[model samples]
Target: MGKIIFYEDRNFQGRSYECSSECSDLTSFFHRCNSIRVESGNWILYENPNYRGHQYYLSKGEYPDFQQWMGFNDSIRSCRISPQHQGSFRIKVYEREDFRGQMMEFTEDCPNVYERFRYHDIHSCHVLDGYWMFYEEPNYRGHQYYLRPEEYKRYTDWGAMNPKIGSFRRLHYFQ
Candidate 1:
């Protein structure tokens, strides 16, 4: 099992909560999350309750401040541990919504989509094998989306702020 601790203040001070599973509403434990410590497994932290709003994907690491996770503010209301994906990591990106237009399938991680696929906007995607993180900018920077073994027929279907995607990385499983 994974262990995650949420702190109400930066540097892991103040009230805190330890979670090993999905939490829809973390407000009952703490008013705000200024810091976090991920001892095991990869997780997705949401800015609002019910897994809505901006999200930050974190692995087994330490985040002494909210900015370390690229959070806009100290409002972290929910979190979910990503399940370990078995076998190989495979994904398909489409240039149009509903999995239409030119497509590219990848088993290895793509740091810059333009360098390889030459696609600027990923309107849809299909995660066929493993978990992956899509970035809004090149070199694995900017907004991110954690995709599992599922199908995202549209950009909005995957909770992306826009259809423009520049890079992607396969999630590393914690053993």
Candidate 2:
């Protein structure tokens, strides 16, 4: 099982809440989340309740403040534990919606999509194996989107407001 702790203040002060499973709404436990500690598995923290809004992917580590996890603010209303994947990773990216344009398959991290695919936008994708994280900028920076094994027919299908995908990486669980 995975374990995670949420702190209401930066530097792990104030009230706190421990969670081992998915939580749709965390308002009752705390008004805000300024810090977090992921002791076990990977996790995805949401800016709004019910898993809606911005997402922040976190691995096993200590986040002394929201910014450490690239959070836009201190508000974290929901969270979900990412299942561990022990197998190989595979993913296919498309340059247009509905999987119709140029395509490329990736088994490892891509720090710059344009450098590898010669394209700045990924309109669709197919996660054939393992989980992946899509970033809005190169080097795994900017907005993040967690994708599991599935077919995304459009950029919106991955919860991205735009088709710009600067980088992507396979999610690997760390002990």
Candidate 3:
């Protein structure tokens, strides 16, 4: 099981809500989320209800403010716990839509995709082993996208607005 707490004010002040599982709509519990504390497990926080809009990937840690998690705002309306993966991680990145064009396979974290793949745009991907997080900028900064073991035939398949992928890393439990 996993534990996470959402705070309505920064530094864990104000009204708060504790969650152990997936929540499709957090609006009933709190109007906004300014801070968060992940006591266990990994999670993905969504900006809009029903798991839409921007996404923020978080592991066991404390986020004193929304910006600490790289949030664009305090609107965290949904969340889902990422299942722990104890095995290896594997993913294949493609340069064009529908799994076309140049391709590269990765089993380890890539802080800068362009440094290894020689391109910043990854249009499609196949997650073959474990959960992964795609970032819009190098060094795992900017927008985040959570991906499970599946096929993403296009950028939109993984909820990305564009094909620009700067960095990527496997999602694992934090010590």
Candidate 4:
């Protein structure tokens, strides 16, 4: 898992988020995430669930008080140039006018590669080694979705879990 930098504007707040290499494109990151700075465990990640793209882990700040930590996340997440990437490390926030859609490029003058995200408004995305990890925005919230090899396994019935239902489960299990 890693973190991405995100901000709506310069005056806007900026916050770090957790990320997971496990999740990519569709989903990633678990519920109980560990933070290096903030204590973690504030509330559910992502205020809403109208998400698309892959999911990964995202994290930010830690505090003794849950409410306080949440407040801090809320405060910093408002900044523009919200850093959005796919990895297991916190990224730097982008500059204003960066949030064109659901992407954040790496080049300052001209980024060779731009990291795509599910949504810059709140959720973040990261790409690692040809994979993607989706994560909720702001440090305080918890997780909404995740995409990873394991989940793929479950969906495809390759590595055990094979968690599915009905005839589709049998069809996937066979495949």
- Say which candidate scores most in lDDT: 3
TM-score of 1: 0.95
Q: Write the per-residue lDDT of candidate 2 for residues 114-141, one digit (tens) a residue.
A: 9999999999999999999999999999
Local accuracy of candidate 1 as per-residue lDDT tens digits, 43-77: 99888899887878988888999899988899989
lDDT of 4 at 58: 28
Cα lDDT, all candidates = 0.89, 0.94, 0.94, 0.25
Error of 4 at 44 (Å): 14
Model 2 weakest 10-residue run by lDDT: 45-54
User: What TM-score, over all chains together, does every model reach?
Assistant: 0.95, 0.97, 0.97, 0.19
Local error of candidate 4 at residue 17 (angstroms):
20
Per-residue alpha-carbon lDDT of candidate 4 for residues 127-172, written as tens digits (9 for 90 to 100):
2222222223332132223332222212221111222111100000
- Give the clashing residue pairs of candidate 3, or none: none
Tell me how many clashing residue pairs each candidate has: 0, 0, 0, 60
Q: Given candidate 1, what's the lDDT at residue 29?
A: 95
Worst 10 residues of 3 by lDDT: 166-175
Pick the winner on lDDT between candidates 1 and 3: 3
Clash pairs of candidate 2? none
Model 3 residue 15 distance off true place after TM-score fit, in angstroms? 1.1
